[model samples]
Target: MSILKKHPERDPGTAEAVGGEELLVTGGHTFKTLTDKVSGIVEQKPPAQWWLIFVMAVSGMLLLVGVIGWLAWEGTGIWGLNNPVGWGWAIVNFVFWVGIGHAGTLISAILFLLRQQWRTAINRFAEAMTIFAVITALVFPGIHVGRIWLAYYMFPIPNQMLIWPNFRSPLLWDIFAVGTYFTVSTLFWYVGLIPDLATLRDRATNVRKKVLGFFALGWRGGNRQWQHYEKAYLMLAGLATPLVLSVHSVVATDFATSLVPGWHTTIFPPYFVAGAVFSGFGMVMTLALIARKIYGLEDIITVNHLEKMNKIILVTGSMVGYAYMTEFFIAWYSQNEFEVFAFVNRAFGPYAWAYWIMFLCNVITPQIFWFKKLRRSIPVMFVASIFVNIGMWFERFVITVTSLSRDYLPSSWDYFSPSIWDILTFVGSFGLFFTFFLLFLRFLPMVALSEVKGVLPEADPHFYHQKEGDTK
Candidate 1:
């Protein structure tokens, strides 16, 4: 019998029932009549749906192959880059992707330390997003080097040239920042994945499961495994918190340390960090919202979870707003003529339209969260998350182009425009992000099944349902 039927005399939707008592919610509805709705949203699909994801994965791989083929065939000229604007779209894409990468670590590591219980439901996907986004971002810099073969030059070693990369250089800092963050984030994610993978392994009855099982590292969720997992998890959380901040801060240095007018501000560290989390959370919100709807995981991703993330959007978003203000203030205060011009130019520059669009998306749209009703409303949050992501892309653009277009001299100023290839590659990157995510959803349990089911009080089978009759 359903929980509602057991307590037919009690009212529904109360605080103690939802929060304190922590019980599964079963409305006065039967599974027979709701089969279509439940199956459409929840309860794994037939074999056909999985095949669609497999097709998408293959297509995504072809796109990468095509991009590499084109990049190799045309050389660097296919991209939009000139003497002054040499960095162009590739670096912009890199920075944007890295910013998007921060969301996972912030959500999983920082929130975990704060002891936010709601995180247990969503952290797995958020961490996965971080790892994938980093993988995507790392590709750009390597390919941007063009040779694609000698890309290893970015590293320093004991042999060969005996010369080291400039440690003081911002670009070198990027290598450390991105490399360390990716390594740490990957470990954190895989560790958390071990037990769940073991769960899937146990549930599997075929050779495919056997292959995936080997990667499960022989996890059994025994007392020993749990103890080691807990300590390792906590240590990783500690290592990652500072690493997350440092990675993006150093990424900001790629622009901040530069003497260029718009990019030279000291505020880039915090500003970039805020923008990263803002975008990362936006992407997380985008994925999480869809995962809940399409997979019927509402029990795990409650409205409260949505509400809390929206609040985070509001908070980090406000920090980004303050950073924007500080950048303009510092520019004017510095009394540097070029610096002053950069700020003025961005507001009324050729890219001013893009600039304001970013402002509306990043600064204005998230303010809706201040209202209780809007935050809990899924539709509202989904649209807002999309806007935040758009605004973040523009933030990178305003930084890259505004500075590149104009510097110390007017004659050197040039308008940077992306060629057709630039646009295609950008779109293709989205395809790549989504395709991998779709595979992640179809396989490996999108909502972290073992983790989510664990959170329900019924999982205990004791406290929440005492002596059968007492639960009523």
Candidate 2:
């Protein structure tokens, strides 16, 4: 039932045969086999490792909840928000999680629009990661506002007090930007899931069937359904594509609009966008490697898919490095003493340790991918991806902390040190992120079964005719 036969003259070990395109899904898999492999993960009991990870993830999530409750009781006073460095780990984590989400929309929307068939294998989980990361990001802003009860004040809902949220606040902009990004991303992710969910629905019985059947929206895979699905998907993709650029730009605007020396810059939009994609791919690469290895999905996810992601990491990493340099150059060229000091202090001042760590991880680590061997090596990319995220987190730290730690006045300057609450709150956010991701992997098809099938050689009408002609 394999859709593709081995090319007689080609090496069997390679993904590509003589003069053919590289296989997206290897192992000579057919439609049925692919479906069975993906769907079986959800249908069967999760492995022991899954349970262990799930337990850890849930524990982390509980820690987050406990921390939030304590934070609400004690108020923001418990955080390490000093006079100069008012924003601490909370804002750093907010931006980090938001940046972590950009790759999903880029993969799911931008690449799909460009007709990159390779996206089929990874886009589903990438889209899911986007939603989850956004969820995590939203939490920081909510809790950081201090009064969790009055968090609703951020919204423009007509209230008895007639107190309106200042529309000019970047925080308000983030509410709309990230909220829309999350909504469309969830819709895009769900639309992509419909066919695969229906596949699961038909394969399940009793309670599972009813549950999946409800979400599947009666997807029968009929031609009419296919047409409507494709149209809806395309529209959503179009809608989401702009959000990829706009969301991060809005985030950058949070910094750019400020008169703070390090923050005030025109380059932040593109710079932030590049960093977001860089960090986003790093996360996707990390998760994809773990998922494929754990589930024996190598043939489906494929090294080619991973290598492509590495290449992106490299490209965006380079862009991020360039942005770093550009920030310094602008600082120097503008002849502004505050800007110069901000950039200089980031490299050599009190928090220079963090700055160099950011530089090493964000700028230098990904340069390894310039080599083909390293790019394709699983271990290298995995470690590099981890470093990429670490560096990216520090990048935000450097930008946020270094800027505020030393401002216009020398006397008011103070070093920002995060309290234990700051550390626990940030760590707990990861727990929340992983909990959602693990649950998603447990319940949903991580790969888009239908989309992957569409890219297979057999999906072409001429494939059958060509095979027959070759035999003749």
Candidate 3:
């Protein structure tokens, strides 16, 4: 029997199916159970695994800090930059991290706008992921400018000499684009947290209560407060929706506007946007699986939720694969030698290995999701998500390294290799990302309790009448 039919009071939305559709939340949870389950993660002492992972994540973050310091002190020469390949893993890492942040905003903003209630289960941490990924991404560009001290020049601050940033430069565009995206995403995340914070506040004692209360902004859960809260959330969601498209499109512009054969393509914006979403969803899937398992949130973060995410990964992966094929077709059709060479070299040249790895991961791995059995399987989806993340990172590497490594002249051509520092920097970035994520899991309500409650049958006015009628 459907959980809803078994427990007539449970409203699992209006979607109908043979067995009355799958429940988004299982285990016969009432609103109280839901709240207690999510809040308990914060209130209780973390498990040993949490402490182990936290220590490792902190180590990685410290390594990242140390590497950045070394880079600043010694200079960019420590990296493997050569004649033609001015860009290296730094830019690749930058783009990769930025793409990682995309899934969070897409989940929180776009899905919310579409009224995807399932999003409520995962949106909180996904939004947090966006914030941390952006923080990690912002680190690269600042240090990539070579002169760490002169990084201020990237900003549009008026000076005594009347010097200004080049408005036309795409690199300059990243500063404003990512900065605005971070600001809005942070606000949206914090706004969503207020009601949950109030819940924590009411339940806490001593310092915890005071801290939660301060962040809760004196929320009384009154009708007037809820009305204002809804309006603000709607406004923020509307604002962030366009950014879901625009931020990555602007990032793509960094490549599209360049005259480099592979980078200079009209198709880049949409292609990059699609790839970003694909990659972002992959990371979210990976984290969600881990979080769900560790916290024993099988009911809240159900297979139904994962299957939906896998479906998105499949769609976006197809789009990404289409973009890949279209790039080659355009290269061949245009009859441009440099462009053709760029695409050809990506497949057959020295870096062809990276290209194929990307192809396998981005194009082939997600194909498994076509089988409903595989998509819903926990292990299969977990591995596939990891592959997607790997493939997307290689996609950036292939684009950045291949095109730059082989330029217009053979004399300027050189193989771009990452030094030990490069590899460490990249690995350490995960430390930074996960450190923040672990802290978020420990201290905050990882699930949006208020939003989740809103989707319950109990939230529906007619639900009680229906239950009463059935009882009669």
Supply the TM-score for candidate 3.
0.95
Q: What RMSD does each model have against the real structure?
A: 5.1, 3.5, 3.7
Using all chains and alpha carbons, the TM-scores for the candidates as numbered come to 0.87, 0.95, 0.95
- Candidate 1 residue 303 C-alpha distance from true site, Å: 1.4
In model 2, the number of clashes is: 0
Candidate 3: 10-residue stretch with minimal lDDT: 12-21
Q: lDDT scores for all predictions?
A: 0.78, 0.91, 0.91
Q: What is the lDDT of candidate 1?
A: 0.78
The TM-score, computed over Cα atoms with residue i paired to residue i, of candidate 2 is 0.95
